[model samples]
Target: MNTSPSPSGAHHVEEGASVRLGALVPLTRPGWVEAGRHLLAGLDLAVTEVNDAGGIGGRPLELVVRDTAADPERAAAAVDDLAGLGVAAVVGEYHSVVARSAAARADALGVPYLCSSAVLDALTEQPTEWVARLAPAQSHGWRIYADFLLGAGRHRIAVVTQPSVYWASGTRILRDHLAARGGTVVELDANELTPEALCDALVDHGATALLLLVGQPEPAVPIVRAVRSDRRLAELLVGAPAGQPEFAEWAAVLGADGAGIPFLRYLPEHLGPLGERVGKELRARLGEAPSFVAFEGWDAVTVLADVLRSHGTDRAAIAGAWPDVAVEGTRGTIRFSRTPGIGVRQWAWPPVQVVDRDPTDADRFRILRTG
Candidate 1:
């Protein structure tokens, strides 16, 4: 966990120079900004813990963070800056499209990056040299969602997605997983065309349940209303893990039917075991309660800290050393891609209902159905 230079290598590594790491997280957006702050807090706490424990090989760990604003374009620029700073590695890219851009930048600069978020299915193909994952991939969500539907003997699913690449890429995985379960999909492109277009979609897509792959919060209103307005569309809901915050405004504006799929790794109030520990540490550091993004941040930092602790802080060393490390994440079971340079796993693909209000606990979210 230390970044200090040993006696033999002390001459090469300047003494007391902080080993800088970078994070390209979406920090300007509404809920995600809160998420980014939490992640930053966790990273800060992790770095503190590392230094208090004697630092990474005796070198102080310094983190350089950039706000990608939940935009892929901004994320690309942020990664460029991180690479310019000669950071050993970076952690966390929330949106897959943003990660794609960062991955490209990481490739050109030869910097190691961990895609802790942005589980889009196609992110694995992004060209990067030193990258690791603290979570599973976007396809995992599809696979899990598919498993749920299949276990229920539900076939013929309706698909709704943003034209944005995140959902676009993930929907394919959903399709493949559903197909594996003998489910046929009737697809509709809800590519931010218009409210009318979105409203018409529910009437058009013929299936028992609907899968929305959009990452934005605004569209939920029209979609939810469309589904509720149409009595023909039963089991109207989303398959992605959009929590209550993102879905809240839409619900308040258009009112929700209390139906849909919400695939989340950890809930805020009931964030499992790791969440309990991480949450406490995060609160201590940030001086406030952690939000969703904090978990993502902790996942990235702890993974990087572990790799640095075991493998050494050098880029190649971190990359070469991370293959077999499996750490218990906030959500649970975070393992790196044994392929090292390959990528992160898409995780937390479990499905819950997209409810109007936060249920007392996770159980009600899973138990109730409105579509």
Candidate 2:
């Protein structure tokens, strides 16, 4: 058995005896560790349940975990290593840029990759059957968010953005969607401007809503604080389409100030029987309510396990099985199809919601709109 240590830690699993799935998550700094934790919780819970029920055809389902740390180069290297290690397929990745790199590398290496959380529409530059994604495309989800902004009567939108492919794509989506609806989009460089200066720009530009397309804690938190403290922008709506507010860390850091900032989430309004059961189990595993990312992680494994059962661990066989997949996930019936503009096979759309923390109770999420 190959018991080599990974960058994060050592994952012990039977080399040839077990069916292995490579898990790529951001478990370290610069990576959204909270989301990674929830994702891992769901993945672990599903793997445990799968094994308990009688692993893939009596052979144990093993997950070899790797921490991407939100780095694209690091993620690409992990994919290479996982492929070398003979993982049946590679799974999981929260950052779109990182997932894009991993996807390109996996495709080149002929390894099947199921992206869990990255929403970038163009996961791969060219159409390839090797990569598939569970999250709604950035265009799909951001357009819904644009509609939500329009419905709320916020016409003048401002985006606080950084220099990243993911953020740039999101800004472009929002701009095109909103501009077609008689709305305007203004982009403010998060790296160039201080939090206070961003608030000033919001006022100067007469923006009614501001979307944060930047990373957490460093500038996102500071920008929110500056905006909240500035009375001039009292009527302004603070939004995060990237779903930074979905995690407990957002509430822990921003408290009541973080509430009312609508963000995108991929979850149904109400849980079904399986969803309810999974939610309970995930909560117990996570020691708190699970984010939609956790559901994505669980659904990823659930679909993969079903695929492995029907089609063995052959890489090409698994990649070819994407179209035939029809597993009941925690959110809904999961399936993959060729979505136009998205190179990789995609779960057409997961349930998208514009949610925010209830002002009275920061712990409770209030669904403002669904699409």
- List the global CA lDDT of all models: 0.60, 0.91
The lDDT, on a scale of 0 to 1, for candidate 2 is 0.91
Clashes of each: 25, 0
lDDT by residue (tens digit), candidate 2, 244-317:
99999999999989999999999999999999999999999899999999999999999999998898877777
lDDT: worst 10-residue window of model 2: 1-10
Candidate 1 lDDT over residue span 9-128, tens digit each? 121224467777887767687325555666677777777777888777788888887888877777778877776676778887666677777876665555667776565555646433
| lDDT accuracy of residue 180 in candidate 1 | 66
